[model samples]
Target: MSSIKVECVVKAHNEIGEGPVWEEKDATLLYVDIYGPSISRWNSLTKETERMSTETYVGCVVPRSSGGYVIGEGTRFAAVDWEKRSITTITHVDTEKSNTRFNDGKVDPAGRFFAGTMAVEVRPTELERKQGSLYALQPDHSVVKHLDQVDLSNGLDWSPDHHIFYYIDSLKYMVEAFDYDLQTGGISNRRMVYRLKEDEGIPDGMCIDAEGKLWVACYNGGRVICIDPQTGTRLQTVQLPVAKITSCCFGGKNYSDLYITSATKGMDEEALAKQPEAGSIFKVTGLGVKGIPSYSFSG
Candidate 1:
């Protein structure tokens, strides 16, 4: 395996830049600033950026086959018009309970939106923490609770063959795998694929490369690791200067450039003083891996 080296590409100070997806058609990188309540697009070729704001916290954003984007925002799913800068709410989740909000999410191969919620308060009691649930938005705009009792639902991705699903609950510090029935949208046979020691930071957002390897952002660990899912073996580690690596995705024309997003949200003054590039976007060249294409909102 080759060594991973990250270099700063876009230095926009994002408060909580999370989910990142590459739009191949537009040759741009699309990501969300959760607390900023906005979705931003950056052109890899021109280095120009455009943003669309939302009324509530934006959790994730993905390209839609019919054009525009599907965005997960504070317990609701919406369609965003890039040209018009408009947002239309398609469905709402946990509307009555303001204490639970959307966290990390992604679109499945079938074009359905999959997003999860987290407790609003940082220190919720055991019961409140269990309120976080993973939701699936059907093509008809109907929603279903796929999984419950989740705490800090974060990383999500699918294997290259599309036969397995991987997810993470940050507090648990484990990356789990499920037998994914893609045609029917069923997940079974859950198993732990990766677990980090207490010294290593919790896993955050993740992506699967074409070789079926998982690349996970190690929050507070200041690194990204490539691991073999079946064997649970660490292939390589890419070090970063910042301690809070929020998420990463493969982009670039050839799908070889690895783009990473870090955060400065939870860092204290002392930590920020030491790592100034905490919230910057980084690009690592020569990754020698290709990522799966972003799923479009066929629904």
Candidate 2:
């Protein structure tokens, strides 16, 4: 197969575009504009875009089996009813810290919603530095803090076999793996899977293709790289016009099209001039890798 060629599929005027999830049922791409505090939907067939306003900065969004979406706002988890245009706060996270907010998150194969938190505004104390945590929310609305003491929790995914979980702390520029027990929600045997060199950009979001290869977004590298999870071998790289590529996922009817999200919030004038399409969504076809379908919240 040829190296993927990425092209802008949608030109979004978002200040920060982060999460991109493709809904197979509706043939639409759903993503959040974190700074915009809005959920945007794009119809791949009709090329129409729709926006829904929210009360907080939305970090990520996933489909719910019951006809709505489960989303992570700054420090809260909520369910949005698209039909009624209503939002119900299901759970509030990190309320005591005041400096932390929810970041990247995804659902496991067993239907549990997992999300991580990050410092919204840095403070000068140890408590403020250790405030971020990873949470697992059960269907009954109960939430559990599974892990803590993270700087910038982002980029979460699972291996195709459901036995390995991949996570990233962007500031550390490393991707870590944990042995995952699908039946018990137990994660152990944590170890570094891939550590980015100083020359490379920080690792942001990631996704696993059908073959179980990991596709990780390079925040300041202006590219997405495919890597062998077990061997840590770089397989391929798809260049983008923006330096802050945030996340990516395989979508489209066949799941062979790769969709990428980017950010423009931190760019200086010089960087912005070089990357005019900083916050736009790009698509790469002929990748030949399909991602696992996103699991919805069962409740």
Q: What is candidate 1's lDDT per residue for 1-299, written digit by digit as tens?
A: 66656788778768788898998877988999887878899888899888888898888887877889888888888898889999998888877677888888888888877889888755321335666888888777788787988888888988877799999888888889999888877788989998887756879999989999999998888888888989988887888888888899998867988999988776678988898887888999877788888898776
lDDT of 1: 0.84
Worst 10 residues of 1 by lDDT: 121-130
Backbone clashes for every candidate come to 0, 0
Candidate 2: residue 181 lDDT (0-100):
92
Query: lDDT per prediction?
Result: 0.84, 0.84
> Candidate 2, after superposition: displacement of residue 257 in Å?
0.8
